[model samples]
Target: MVEETIKLAYGEYSDLIKDKRIAAVQALSGTGACRLFADFQKRFSPNSHIYIPVPTWSNHHNIWRDANVPQRTFHYYHPDTKDLDFASLMDDVKFSQNAPKGSFFLLHACAHNPTGVDPTEEQWKEMSYQFKVKGHFAFFDMAYQWFASGDPEKDVKSIGIFLEDGHLIGCS
Candidate 1:
């Protein structure tokens, strides 16, 4: 079962692994990936908190909380508009001026479920810059990489931004 899952995740995340571009691994699924990442974060950066986006997949909160990692939230969806709250998000990110150096962040790779809202490419680039300035580590869960556009690569646009910034990445 684990091997099969690995094969599937590898096939889906091949671009990063084959290119020696990312330190990658296989996970049981999205939940497993998040759990593993949370564990890793807690293990190495014991004092850092994880910045989760508001309105993210609920299980994300559970996974991190269970791992005993402190959690923080940044703005995400706009309830009034039923879309991304880009300005509010940027402001919130900017406000995170003290999220600890080398802290961890989790990004939903694509096809944000339930709400179905995603950040624009420009916004992702800006977020990547913010992560860089804050010295945050990104652990991406690309579970639905092919669902957003029926093109796996296109679905990982957010991950692409982190890569462009030369940040070490872990994808599943």
Candidate 2:
């Protein structure tokens, strides 16, 4: 399957992803891609950790664990308000020392699966800057790109922020 077509059809930053700098590979599913990435992470950044939101795809934990990659948790959803929990998320990110280098962070591009909440543009920009400072890698999963807002551009805004900041990204 042609990823470029998929990107263009969804209108989710197809041009940027199509740039010669990116390297794309085929996967049977998101879980498969995550598993492959987990294995790759183990090989390339053996000491690096994979930071996932407190609540993400349940399969995420299994994929990384089965791949032999050490897993770490970061703040995301607020138990009380059931919202973005931006402050706690930032606090966790700011205080995270484990993301020293070569660390991978999993981000939901849009329509957060379970929470159905996403960070604002301002929040995304802040996180992008923070990640830049920490030298961390971002892995975005855009499965629900158009399902949330019915507009792909709005859905993938976070990823665009990273690209604008000159960050290399991997997505599935």
Candidates in order, TM-scores: namely: 0.83, 0.90
Worst 10 residues of 2 by lDDT: 5-14
Highest-scoring model, TM-score: 2
Clashing pairs in 1: none
Tens digits of per-residue lDDT for model 1 on 38-70? 898889888878888888888988998999998
- Those runs of model 2 whose alpha carbons end farther than 4 Å from true positions after fitting are 9-19
Candidate 2 backbone collisions, by pair: none
Model 1, position 153, has a per-residue lDDT of: 59
* Model 2 per-residue lDDT tens digits across residues 1-172: 6566456433445565556456668887778877878887889888878899989989889998999888898889988997889988877666656455556899998888788889989999999998888778998887787788897677778888998898987777
Candidate 1 Cα deviation (angstroms), residue 8: 8.7
